[model samples]
Target: MQFRYLGRSGLKISEITYGNWLTHGSQVENDIATQCVRAALDAGITTFDTADAYANTKAETVLGDALAGERRESLEIFTKVYFPTGPAGPNDSGLSRKHILESINGSLTRLKTDYVDLYQAHRYDFETPLEETMQAFADVVRQGKALYIGVSEWTAEQLREAHALAVDLGVQLISNQPQYSMLWRVIEPEVVPTSKELGIGQIVWSPIAQGVLTGKYAPGQPLPEGSRATDEKGGADMISRFMNDRVLTAVQELKPVASDLGLSMAQLAVAWVLQNDNVSAAIIGASKPEQVHDNAGASGVKLDADVLKRIDEALGDLPESDASQTRSPQGRPS
Candidate 1:
């Protein structure tokens, strides 16, 4: 796998990061999760991303256990806060000082590590004071609990404010993790440019548009059995927006593009996002080991200009690039 620096930091991470969001501890059993992790390691993926709120905080424990025997220095581990992870309490959520501090401790314990390579705010906490959140993140770095800081799905305005506060606090806000894909381009217009100017890199998730770009969900076919669409645990609903005929058909149009490039639909989708210089890595979630190996094929693949234009044409207007649609502060769990 190809490696790239995380933002302007000296640290480097695999271009394809193995992420366990809906799969680890929830969609897949722990033993299968271990196999997937091993597959990622075998494919030369050194970066792993998880969140404290994923699977009600069980994802961190499972990922920690899976990586327990690996050399700590050989991996880049990332996790996030800002979503409720435990029993519903007022302070059990958001970027409040109480939540950020306590959440880090909880995450470290569950991860079985003293520090994470990067700590991110899972969402923009509209409820908290920006200064309080920034200061708390600075304190995390000062305490060596996290080597660097990042934010997920923060709008350009929110990121600007937080970045200024981070600079004032003498801390490096190194990265931003957002939902980016062939179908979701919300970060392109504003977030990507702003992050590039501010020395922050974009570590994008859902490059496959929740499996829509994989070309597995055909226009008129039934939902793939045992796929995320048929997953009874809510993965189906998460991908419902792209289940329509128009989206599925548009995705089907890209099959030839993949064929011309000698890439699987998933590889083309992942590589499409990496074409942007600001994107440091694309996080891929998998249920099977083969998925990990298949996505790794996109690691160093380069898409020429004509292929990119064809992708845009094939996708038509189905992509969402509006900055407004982002930072919605919705009910998404990581």
Candidate 2:
């Protein structure tokens, strides 16, 4: 696996990192999670990304359990805050000072590590003061509870403010996690350029557009068995949006590109996102060990200029509006 610097920080993370989102504590059982993590490690994936809200906090525990014994130090663990982990009472969520302090300690306990390599705020907390949240993150870095800090799903302006605050306070805001894929290129116009300008790396999630770019769900086809669409989770609506004929046709056109390059559709999709120098890493989610192995293969594929042009022509114009405000089922940017 190829390692790149995370943003402008001294820390370096593998280009292909493992992420626990809908899988770890949800679709995957303990044995499967263990195998998946072991497969990722065997493939040289040192970075593992998780969030407190994933699987109602079970994701972190399962991931931590998988990294137990002598394997912990061999990995760089990242998790996010700002999501409700319990009753949605006051101080239960958001980036308030109370929530930030409590959430970090809670995450540390569940992750089985005293310090997270990177701690990210899951999203912008409109209710909390920016300075308060920034200061809270800085305090944790100073206390050694988190080695680095980042933000997710934040606008360009918010990211800039956070970076400036970190610099002024002598803290490092190393990276920003966002969703960037062929099916969703909204971040390219603003977030991507701003991150590059500010010297922050982009650790993008959902690089495959939640399987839409894999060419699996063709138009009019029933949801595949055991797929997120068929599961009782909230992804069915998102799946419905991606099942449109236009999206499927676009994916079909890209199949030839992947075939020509001797790569799977998923690999091609991931490689396309990593083509941007601003992207530090692409976080891939897997329910099985084979999926992890398959994603890791993306590291070997590179999309040349011609291939990139073809992809862009096929995808056409992606809507730049934020999907989160509409209660989109898939993971939002970050």
Candidate 3:
């Protein structure tokens, strides 16, 4: 596996991180989730990303069980806050001091670890003061609960403000986790530049656009059985944005590009995100062990200028690059 430094932090993470988001506790059975985690480890992946909000905190437990016997020092485990996980109480969510402190303790216990390599704000809390949030994160770092701090789906301005506060509080805001893929370019224009200037790396999610880039969904054909588009728990809604015929047709055009590179559609999609120098890793979720092995192959793959141009051409105007598209909840969750 290829590893990269997260942002400017000394910590190196596998470029292809195994993430349990829609799967693990929700879509896949516990046994299958454990098998997938083992498959990732076997494929040389040492980075694992999860969140307390996933499956109402069940994802963290499953991941903890899966990594129980692994050498703790060799793995970089990450989790997040800012979403209602427990009882969805007012104090159960957001980045308030109370929530951050309580959430970290709960997360550490659920992950079966003393400290997470990185702890991210799952989303920006408009209701909370940014200072309170950063201060709490600093405390988490100083207390040895999380080594570094990060935020997900935060805007460029939000990142700028948070990074400044993080610096003042003496915490390392090392990474930003966002949805970035061939079909989703929202981070390219604003977030990437701001993060680069702030010395933050991107841990991008949905590099395959929720499996749309896998070419499994045909332009005018029926939805693939058991595909993400058909997952009702949450996947179907997340992938719904790309389910239209125009997007599907554009996605299908990349099949030949993958063939030319001798890569499966999924591998191409994963590698495409890694092409960005600022992207330290691409988060890949899996329901099966083979899927982990397949996506892991994208670790060190390089896509040249020609291939990149072909990708853009195939995708056409289907990609979303507006800076406004990168946003968090306008109001507090729950």
Say which candidate scores most in TM-score.
3
- Over 4 Å off in model 2, which ranges? 318-334
TM-score of each: 0.97, 0.94, 0.99
lDDT of each: 0.92, 0.85, 0.95
Which digits, one per residue and each the tens of the lDDT, describe model 1 over residues 167-231?
Answer: 99999999999999989998989998899888899999999988889999998888878898898
In angstroms, what RMSD does candidate 2 have relative to the true structure?
A: 3.0
Off by over 4 Å in 1: 330-334
Candidate 1 lowest-lDDT run of ten: 325-334
| Cα-based RMSD of candidate 1 | 1.6
Number of the top-ranking candidate, with lDDT as the measure: 3
Cα displacement (Å) at residue 9, model 3: 0.8
* Per-residue alpha-carbon lDDT of candidate 3 for residues 1-334, written as tens digits (9 for 90 to 100): 9999999999999999999999989999999999999999999999999999999999999999999988999999999998897789879999999999999999999999999999999999999999999999999999999999999999999999999999888889999999999989999999999999999999999999999999999987988888899998999999999999999888888989999999999999999999999999999999899999999999899999999999999988889999899888888878
RMSD of each: 1.6, 3.0, 0.7
Q: Candidates 1 and 2: which is better by TM-score?
A: 1
Sort the predicted structures by lDDT, highest score first: 3, 1, 2
